[model samples]
Target: MIAWIRFAVSAVLIVTGLVSFAAGVIGNCRFGYVMNRVHAGGIGDTQGLFFIVLGLAFGEGSFMDILKLALLIVFMWNTSPVSSHFLSQVEYYTNPNLYEHMERK
Candidate 1:
């Protein structure tokens, strides 16, 4: 019973992670511009990765593996936003008519 419960929980988490990934893919495909695409990609990088790592951790029995996964998730959570910001800055500077897509505040 315990093993079955673990299996069920892990399966649910993995499925949730997959769904998050799917959402990100759809968002990336649907968005029109670089900044919008970066936002969509960031969703997958952080939330999708978090769920996937959390699911993997649930399946693993070893403490060290779980700790490593936890660290990976933390690292991703920290970096995804910074990378997105950098990409946005790059887009802002490089795009010749940035004002057409976004209004300057």
Candidate 2:
């Protein structure tokens, strides 16, 4: 029974991760601006990765596997936002009419 429960939970988490990735793809394709696409990509990088890794960890029996997955999640959590910020700044600096899309204070 416990094993079955674990399987079900892991399956749900993996499916959720897949759904997050799908949403990110849709958002990236639907949005027009590079910054918007970067935001969507960040969703997949962080939440999608976290869910997938967490599901894999749930299915694994070894402590080391779980530790590695946890580390992976931590690494992404730390890096994804900084990467997104850098990309956004790059877009902001390079785009000729960036203010056209964004409202000026």
Candidate 3:
């Protein structure tokens, strides 16, 4: 029973992570603005990665595996936001037409 519950939880987490990633991809495709796309991607990247890592760790994971996943999550959490910020900064500084292409049409 406990094993089945664990499996269900892990499955749900993994599926949710995949859906989040797909949503991000859709957001990127639908938006014309670079910053918007970056924002969506960053959010999805972090959330999906965290969810997937947690799912993996929850499924028959030893302490060391969970520890490693924790570290991985921390590393990715730190880097993803900073990279997104940098990308947004570059777009802000380099793109003179940054605000021009934001129409929803």
Predicted model with the maximum lDDT: 2
The list of candidate 2 runs beyond 4 A from truth reads: 103-105
Best by TM-score: 2
Alpha-carbon RMSD of each model: 2.8, 2.4, 1.7
lDDT of 3 by residue, 1-105 (tens): 988989999999999898889989999999777888998898687999988988888795799989988999999999999999999999889998876776666
For model 1, residues 1-105, the per-residue Cα lDDT tens digits are 988887788888888888888888998999888888998888888888887887787788689999999889888888889999999999988889988888754
Of the pair 2 and 3, which is ahead by TM-score? Answer: 2
- Local distance difference test, candidate 1: 0.86
What order do candidates take by TM-score, descending?
2, 3, 1
Q: What is the C-alpha lDDT of each candidate?
A: 0.86, 0.90, 0.88
Clashing pairs in 3: none
Give stretches of model 3 more than 4 Å off. Answer: 102-105
Residue-level lDDT tens digits of model 2 in 1-105: 999989899999999999999999999999988888999999999999989898888888589999888888889899999999999998888989988888743
Worst 10 residues of 3 by lDDT: 96-105
